[model samples]
Target: MFMRKNQIKCVSKAVLVIIILLFSNELLAQNQRVNSKSNNYFWDNVQFGGGIGLGFGSGYTDISLTPSAIYNFNEYVSLGLGAQYSYVSQKNYYNSHLYGGSLIALFNPIREIQLSAELEELRVNINPNDPSLTSEQFWNTGLFLGAGYRTANVTIGVRYNILQDDNKNVYSDAFMPFVRVYF
Candidate 1:
């Protein structure tokens, strides 16, 4: 029998991440020639992955897309850059869109756990219905530090926003979750 629509969608998303990781891993296994006589450099060691998130509350909806690429300096160290786009809609409340980029670092003492850090800069725009309050746009910055676990292809973790904005931003919560799929 056919599964429900939402179930089918979830299955497809899972398959997509797995397929991406498997395909990239196959390419990574190649030791083919980079030149006539030269070997590949450190830049040859790279992986790509990121998380997708969606949320619903009593009167609001949140959807986001985050993609990232990481380059390995060694087994224990790597650097990455990623982008985030999110839209929030609420009944009787303002609607907003958030766009941001993050610089990420990961250090793994072992194969299973990693220490992480990110510096993010975000621009948020909100449109309110009230005539007294004008539509607003502002930039906010956050520095986050946390740890996570990594398996063969997926990572799940939580982070605390160490530098939270007090007056002009909506992400006042100090903690958040992160997921990634390594390609």
Candidate 2:
């Protein structure tokens, strides 16, 4: 039996969604380790941070906002969740919007080195200005592995998306540089 491209895309998306659901369930179970007696302990171990982006040019505009929170299980390990929203437009071309959520894990082997893994799922909508061109909508998933140099509450690093597909993924490339801060 042979599958068409669209069929394959649909199957792959379904598989990705299933995997994310299963993994998130495991991550949620970690909350059970928290002590119910002291709410302060939970609050004390939490950190909040994320990113904001803006760009504009002669005929283009882009904007993004991401906010996240993490719970430190210990000095060395942390787990978190994040939300994403992005809008992009090119005059006389197309406009796009993306909304997503992510699960992230951070590991610090020493005080200055941080390693991370992040899984993200986004819904993308693209609308073309020309009536002849059809609109498009799809789901995109990315798994990024990264390492960074950390100082105080900031980290600078690069990450590679292992699951990026040039045609279907939102990112223009598999490798992305990042600056992260937490407080």
Highest TM-score: which candidate? Answer: 2
> Number of clashes in every candidate structure?
0, 0
**Per-residue C-alpha lDDT of model 2 across residues 1-183, encoded as one tens digit per residue:** 356888999999999999999999877775655545368788899999999999999999999999999999998999999999999999999999999999999999999999999999999999999999999999999999999999999999999999989878889999999999999
Model 1: what TM-score?
0.74
Count backbone clashes in candidate 2: 0
Over 1-183, each residue of candidate 1 has an lDDT whose tens digit, in order, gives 356888989999999999999988877665344342233565467788777889999998999998989998899999999999999988777889999999999899999998899999989999886667889899888988978999987778899888886676568687988776878
Q: Ten residues in a row with the worst lDDT in model 2?
A: 29-38
lDDT of 2: 0.95
* Model 1 collision count: 0
TM-score of each: 0.74, 0.79
lDDT of each: 0.85, 0.95
